[model samples]
Target: MDSSEQQDNLTESSGCAQAALFGPFQLIMKDGAEVLISNRRARAMLAMLCLAPDEPIDRDHLSRLLWPGRFEAQAKASLRQCLSDLGKLLAAADCDLLDISRSRIGLKAGAVRTDLSDLHDLLTEGKYLEATERLVSIGAIPLLDQMNYGEAFDDWLSVHRQQAEQRLQSAVSVALSALEKGDNLSEYARLSSLWSVRHPPAQTIADRKQGKVRIAVLPFKSIADPADHGFFADGVVDELITSLGQVPQLLVAGRTSSFQFKDSDKPPSKIADTLNVSHLLEGTIYRQGEQVRVAVSLVDAESGFESWAYCYDGSLDDMFAARAEVVQAITNGLSDALKLTEHASQPRKLTSDRKAYGLYLQGRALTIRAIGDGVLPTAIELLEKALEIDPEFAECWTALAEAEINMTVFTPCLDRLERCEKAAGYAKKALCLSPQQAHARIVLAFYAWTQNDIIGALDLAFEAYRLEPNNPDVLNRVGSFLLYCGRSRDALPYIEASIDQDPVNGRNYAILSGVHLNLGNIEAAVEAGQRMVDLGFPSLWLAAALAVSGDREAAIETYQLTKKLMNTVIYPPAGSAPLNPDAMDAYWLMAAKGLWSGKDQDRKNYCMVLEMLHATLHDPCDSTIVLPAIWMGEAPMVFKTLGTQITTANFFAFMSLWTNAEPINRVRLHPDFMDFVERIGMVAAWEKYGWPDLLPKPSTII
Candidate 1:
C-alpha cells in the first residue's frame, strides 16, 4: 500500500488486510477485512515465515514444527491445504505472494506484514542498534518462542539461520568497508573469490572458440579373449586416445561416441565422413606369445589416401608405450600439414647419477604439472640440490635452470632475466663441457628461447634433435618450435618420435591431438581430446581440445571458469605490449584458431581462445622460461625478444631468445595493424600500451 495514500481507518471490514499475528494464533487481513485462524498450530507455522522476511522455510521441517512429534504425514497434508487456504485468504484481500515455494512454508512477503521483518530489514540496512531492540518484542510471541524445541526441522532451520546471520554479517562488512578510511582491496577480493568458489556462477567455464574435427577411436579388439582380459582392449584404445587428446588443438572424439562403431569393418574414409572428419585413423591389437603387436594407419578423407602407417611389436610389459607408438605414426602421416619439430633419436648415455641423476630426471619430468596445479617446490629443490651435489653434472644443472625458468614462466615471482641468464649459463656450460650431449643442447636452446633469440633456440633445438631423435622430450620440444614457426608439417616427425618413445605421457597425447586437428582429422582430434581429459589430465587442455571437437557442452563448463579467472589466461608482466595490438594480432589469432579444433565447441569457448591468445602472446616476451611453452605449443605467437617485438621485415635475424623466427611483429608496425585495430574499435591497446608505445618502438624490442 502507498504510504502517501489518504489514511484508511484501522477497523474490521470486508476488504481484508492480511496481518499475521505472532503470539498464539494466525490471522489474515486485507483491504480492511480480517480472517482470523483459531488453530495455534497453524499460527505457529505462519510465525516461522513471518520471522524470515525473504528466506525460504523448508516444508519437511514445517510439518514437524506444527505437529511436534505426531501426525507427520497427515500434518504435512493438512499444512499444505492450510497454507493454500491462507494464500487465498490473503490474495482475496489483494495481498501478493513475494515467494511461495513447495519446499517450505514461505510467506509471500507482500501478502502479509510482520514486525520481525521490519526489525531484520532495519538491521540489514545498518540500523543495527534499533533492530536489536525491535527483535525482543518480535521474538516473544508464544508460538514463535518454541522454534528450537524440536529436532525434526533442526537441520533446515540451522542452515537458514546461519544464512541469515551471514547475510547480516555481509551487510555489516560492506558498510564497514565503505566507512574505513583505507581499503583492504586484496583481502576483499580474496574473500569474494572464496565465496565464489564455494558457490560458483551458473557456468563454471566459458565457451571456447570452436575448431572443426569430429574424430573418434575404435575400441581395440582384444586378442586376449579370456574374460579375465576384458579390460585390456578398452584400456589400450582409451590410453591411445587419452594420450593423443591432451593437445588442446585436437578434436578427439569421446570413447562412447567412437566405440559404438567399433569392429564394424568400416573403411577409414567412410568412418571419417560418418564422423564428419577430414581424416580417419584405424588400428588393430593382437597378442602373440609374450609380445603384443599393435598396428595403426592414418587415411585422408578426400582421396581415400593412405597417408601413413606404422606397427609396434613389443612384450606385454611394454604395452605402456604401445599407444604412444600408434599416436606417433598417425602424427607422422599428417607431417606434411603439421610441422611437428622433434628429434630423430634418444640419448645413448647409459649413465645414472649415484642417487641424484634418476631423481634429477624424475624431477625434470614432473615440471609444469597439469592445469591449475603448479610444479611442486620440492621438485625444484630436488633438482637444485642434485645440481649442487654434482656441479660438474651438466644435465642436473641444466634441469635446475629449466625448472627455475618454468617457475618464472608460470608466475613472475621468479626473476625473468636472472633465471633465463642462469638457465643459459647452465645449458651453455653443459654444451661446452659435453658438445655431443643432446640434453645439454636442449638446455641451451631452452635458455635461448627465453632470451627471444629465435635462431639460437632453433639451432640448439635441432642439434639436440639430430643427436637424440628418439628422445620423446627432445622430440616434443622440437615439434613445439616447428609449430610456433607455422612449419607444422615439419613438426610431425618430431612429435611422432616422441610419441613412439613414450605414448602414455600426457604431453605426447596433447601433441598428437594438435597434429591430427591441423591435418583436418576431426575424428582423430576429438577422440584424442576426450581421451586426454578422461585420463586425469587438466580439464583446460581437455576442455579446449573437446571444444574443438564440436562437443561444446563438454568444454563449456571449464571455458566459463577460464573467463572469470582471466588472469589464468593472460600472462603477467607483458611490459608495454597491450594484448590488442596488430603486431600481436596474427600470433593471437592463428594460434587461437588452431589451439581449439572443433567448430561448434570452439564457438562456445571463445573466451578461452582470447585468453589463450593473450597468454601465448605475452608468454614469449614475458616468460623467462620457454620449456612450458615448448611443452604446450601455445607459445608460438607469444615468442618475442627479451625487450622488443620483432618485425616481419627483419624476420631473417634473431637478436634474442624470445623472438619469433618469422618476425611477426613488423606486420603490426605496418599499416595493417593500425587499420585492423581501428576497425575493431578496441581500446584495450590504448589502455595497456598507448599508440606512441608501438610507433618507433624498435629500440625497445631487444
Candidate 2:
C-alpha cells in the first residue's frame, strides 16, 4: 500500500483500539484482544512512547530514562531486552506499535490509541465537553494508575498525574462557572461530583493570622432521628468548619475539639467556655424529602446573647450554597465581610457528593470515638471504605492514620513491629497527600518516638501543635511527648490547655496527673488522678499519689477499689504510709500477705506477684520498678537498671527515682551513680527542674 493509504489505515485501526490509563493501565486490541505488558521496563517504555507517538526519542535517552541506575552497557542491554519483549507482545496482538531502529525508538503514529493522549489533546483544545467525557470514561483516575517504576519513571508519572489532574480540574471549573452563570446546573453538578470523588479537597489549614477572632462551630444537631439524618448534620458541620476556616479573620477550633460537645447538654455559653472561644456557632439540620432547613445562630459566649440567627431553607442539592451563606452570616456577625480579605468572603466548594462526604464525616466520628473505646478495627474499616469512594480525601487519610495509631497503642491485635510499620506507613501517606495535615504529623511524631528519635518526635509534635493550637488531641500528643523526653514542666501548659479545650477528656486528666507527679506537685497530681478515676479511667496513678502522701487508709482503699474495678487482685496496699523506699517495699509485701491471709499457698503467690510487678516495669529506667527497688532496699538492682538505661530519653525519670527514693538517695555518694549522673547530664536537668523536696541531704563525706 502507498504511504498515505497505510497512514489512514493505521489511524482507523488505532481509533478502534482502546487504552485505559485509569485505576489500572490496560491495552485492548480492535478485535477485543488484550495486550499485556507485565515487565516494569516494558510498561514504562510503552507508556512513554504512547504518550508522545509522533516524536522519535533517542535510544540512549530511552535507556537512561527507563534504567537510570544501571551502567551504560547494562542499561542498553536491558532496554534491548525490553524492546524485544515488547515487539513480540505487539506482534501477538497483530500491531506494529513501535518504530524501532538501532539508533532511535518511537511509536508508529496512529497505530495505537490511549486515554492519556486523547485527554491531553481534548484539554489542549479546551473542549470542556469532550474533556469531561474522556475524564468520566476513564473514571478520573491517577495517571499511569498504581504503577511503580523506578525513581525516574515514578517521578515522571507523578508530574504527569498532577498535570492531568489540573486539566481535569480546569474542565470541572468551567462546568462550575456555567452553573454560576445560570446554565446546566444538574450536568455540571454531576461532573463536579465525579471530580470531587477523584480529587477530594484536603483539610483546611488552621488560620495563623494574628489577632483573629476565635469561634467554635458546634456539631450541628439533628432535629430528626439521628439514624435518619445524623450524617447530614455531620457533613454540614464539617463543611461549615472548612468554610469558616478559610476566613483569615477567624481562628476556628478544630473539628475534633468542637465535636467533643456533640452529645453534651451544655448550653452555648458553657460549650464556648469549655472550648475557650468568644463566640459559638451552633446549628441544627432538619430534612424532609428533597427539602432541608438549616438553622444557625452565632452566640456571644460572655453575654449569652444570640448575635445572629438565620434559618436557611433550600433544596438538599443547595447544601453547599446554604453553608456558604451561613459562613457569610458568621463573618458578618464577627465583622463586615466587605472589609475582610477578599479570599475570606470567597465561597469554596468542599464536596459535591454528599454521600461520600457523609461517609467521611461518619468515619471521623467513629475514629474519634475509637480513641477511648477499643473499636479501632471498625473505625479503620469505615475509613478505608470512605477512601475507596474518594481516594484523594486527605482528611480521611489523616483519620485513618490516627485510627491505625490508636489501634497500635490501645489494641492488642498486631505485633509491635507490624503495628509500627502500618501506622508509620499511613502517617507518611497522609503527609504525602497533604503536607500541612496536623493530625498526620502527630501520628508521625508518635511513630518517631517508637523509633527512638526523641528530638525528631518532639519537633514534629511541636510543629503539629503550631498548625492547630486549639486541637486538644494535638496538645495532648505534644504534651505527652514532652513528658516522655524529660521536659515535664514544659509539658504542663500544653496538657492544661488540652484540658481547657476538652475538660471531660479522661486521657488529658491522666496526662495531667503524670505531669504533676513529674513536677513533684503531689497535691495537684492527686487531684488530677482523682478526676481521671471519676471519669472511668484507671486508678493506679491515684493510688500511687495516695501512697506517697502518707494516707495509708485511703491508699489501701484506693488500691482495693482499683482491684475490684479491674476484677483482679494485682496491686499491693500501702501500710503506715511509708516514709521511705524501704518502708514502701515492706508495706507492699505486707499488703500481699494480707491478700493471701488464709491461703497456705501464700508464699508462692507473693513471689509470683512480686515477679509480675517487676516484669511489668521491665524497661530499664521505669520509675515504677526503680522506686520500689529503692524502698525495698534493692540498691544493686536500682543501680544496675539505671546503668543500663543511662542513654535513654527518660534519664531524668531515673534520676528522680534515685533522688526521691530516700533510701537509694545514698547513691549520691557512689562512684557508679556519679558517673551515670555525669554521663546522661542529669545535673543540668536537676538544676532546671529543681531537686524534689524528698531528696536526701548531701553526705559530708562526699
Candidate 3:
C-alpha cells in the first residue's frame, strides 16, 4: 500500500502505540502504559522489525539469530513461541503493530510511531529542521541499549546500530543544508551545538586503508623524584612521534590523541582500540639530576603483548645523542615487529648545544600550550635564550616566530601589527636557514595576509602545504588562507583533511566553520563553531556566525562568553594592559547591547563606539564598524569603513564580509560595491581562481 494508505491503516489499527528504539527499548501503548516483554528474544525480534519497518525478515533467519546454537526445529519452535507471546501482549494492549505472513514477519508500515521511523520520515521528506530537532531530543543514546540476544543477534545488532549512527549523521548534514538554504540561524546554532556534543571529530580504524599498520605512541611515564622531569619525557615523546610520522609507511596517531591517554589506567588493548591503532608504543623515563634512564616497549594492541622492548642510558650533557639512540631503537624495533620495509629517516637535530636544545623544547611546549597569563611571553624568552646560545638554530627561530604570532591573539595588549612584523622577521630567518620549514612558511603566510598581500599569502600557504602535505597545521593554514581569500569551495578539502589528521584542534574547526558559513552551510557552520567552543578556542567567530544566522540571543550570549574568556582566562601579561581599557569595555558593552537589541538605533550606537575605539586606538582601518553598520542598514557607513580599510591596505577584515547574507548583500548591492571589490584586489583573485559561491563575476556585477 501507498504511504497514506498505510498511515490510514495504522491510525485505525494501532491506537496510540509508540515504540522507543533509542536508549532503553520501550513499547508504550494507549494512555502511556508500557508493555512489558520479559522475553529477550521477543524484544530483539521487535527491535529488528522496528529498525526495518515494512521490510520482512525470513523466519529461518530470524530463528537462527534468536536461537544461535539450537537445532533448526527447536529454534523454529522457540521463534514461534516468542512470536505468539509478543502478539498476545500487543493484543492485550489493543495494538496491531506487526505484519506476519506465512514465511516472513515484519513491523507493519506506520503501524507504530517510533523515534527511528520518525527520523527517517523527516529526513526523507527533506524536513531537516524537524529531523535535527528530533536528533537533538534523542541526544546520543544508542539504539536498544539494554537488549542483547545470542551471538548471532548481537552481531546483527552491532551492524544495525552502526547503520543508525550513519543515518543520524546524514540527517545532521541534510539538516544543515536545509537550514543554510532557509537562513534559519537560531535553529542552526542549536542543532549544530547538539551535533558537536553528539559527534566529536576523531578518526577511527575505518579512516585507514585495509591492512595498514596504525600505531599510537602513548606518553612516557617519568620515574623521577618530584616528577619535575615529566616535561622532559613529554618532549622526548613529541620528538619520537614526529620522527616516526616521517616514515611514510606508518600511520601514527596524532600527539593530541595519543597524549589524551596519559596516566590512563586502561589496558594496552583497550587504549589501542580507542585510538584505532593496531599497535602501541609506551615507555618510561627515569631522571636523577642530569643523568637519565629510558625504557621503551612496543605492544600488539590485539593481544596486549610486548612485541619488542629496549632501554637506553644517557646524561643531559649528551641528550641529543641519547634521544637519537632511543628513536633509532624504536624505529628498528617497529620495523622488525611489523615486518616493514621502509625505515624512518635519520633524526634532524634542532641544535648541537644541549642547553639550547633543552630550552627550545621547553619553549616549544609552552608555545603549543598557547594559553594562560605569561605563558607565551615566557616561551618567547626561553626561545630567545636558545637562539642566543645557538645563533643558527632554525627550529628555535620557528618556535620563537610561532610564540610571537600567538602573542597577538592570547596577549591582546601587545601591538598586533608589531607582533606580526616580528613574527615575519623570525620566520624569514628560519626559512633562510632551513628552506623546508613549513611552520615558518605558515607564519609568513599569516604575516603576508595581514600586510594585504593576498597573492603572496596564498603562495606561501600553498608552498607550506606542498612541503608538508600531511601536516595538519600546514593543511589548516592553507585552508584558512584560501577561506580568507573568499575561496571556501577550494578550502574545504584541505580543512577536512586537516580535521582528519588533527581532529581535536579547535583552530581547525574555527576555520572549518568559517568556510561552511561563507558557503551558506549554516548547519555545518554551527557544528564547527560548537566544536571550536568545546576545544576551548575563541568563540568570537562563532558568535559572528550566530549573528548572521539570525540567532541574536545566542550571538549575544556567545559574544559575552568570549569577552569573559578573554578577560579572565586569556589575560595579557602582568605588566601590560590595554592602552584604552575603558574604550575596550565600552566596545564590548555596545557590541553586546546592539546584538541583543538588534535595533537600528542600538546598532548605530555600536557604530559610534567602534568609531570612538578607532579614534582612541589610532587605527585607521577600523573594520569593527562594518558589521554594526550592516546591521544598522547603513550601506554608506559600510562602504566608508571598508573604503578606509582598503585605502590603508588592510584586507584582513574583508575575508568575512564577502558573502550573500542579507546583511552583507546590503553592502554588495551598494552602487560602489564593484569599485570596492576592484580596489581590494578580490576581482583579480576571483578571476584567477573562481568566483565566490554566492557572488557573480565582476563582468556580471551590474
lDDT scores in order: 0.47, 0.60, 0.70
Q: Give residue 407's lDDT in candidate 3 (0 to 100).
A: 76
Q: Ten-residue segment with the worst summed lDDT in candidate 3? A: 197-206
lDDT of 3 by residue, 85-180 (tens): 999988887888888888999876666777677777677677766666665455434566545567778788878877776777787787777887
Would you list the rank order by TM-score, best first?
3, 2, 1
Q: Which is superior by lDDT, 2 or 3?
A: 3
Shift in Å, residue 446, candidate 3: 1.6
Higher lDDT: candidate 1 or 2?
2
Give the C-alpha miss distance for residue 57 in model 1, angstroms.
90
Q: By lDDT, is 1 or 3 better?
A: 3
Taking the tens digit of each residue's C-alpha lDDT, what string does model 1 give over 1-702?
Answer: 111110132232222233333222234443343445444445556555655656666777666666576677887887777777766755664656536566755654365554334434664575544443433233212213224436655554555545644564565456446434346454443333222221111111111114423345566666753642434555456445544444334445544445546667777666666555566666676876667877766667778776677677788666543444545554544443434343222222212344465456456555534123456455677777776667676656656666765655554342455665776677677666556666667656656554445545555665565454334576677666554443344456666555443444543565666655555455775666555555544334444445545665655554434433343345434343445545344443433443343343532354344445445543343332222222223223323221243222122122111122112233333444444333322122221111121232221122
Q: Ten residues in a row with the worst lDDT in model 1?
A: 200-209
Report the CA-based lDDT of candidate 2 relative to the real structure: 0.60
Best by TM-score: 3
Instruction: Please give the TM-score that candidate 1 achieves against the real structure.
Output: 0.34
Task: Give me the runs in candidate 1 sitting further than 4 Å from their true place.
Answer: 1-376, 410-414, 539-555, 558-702
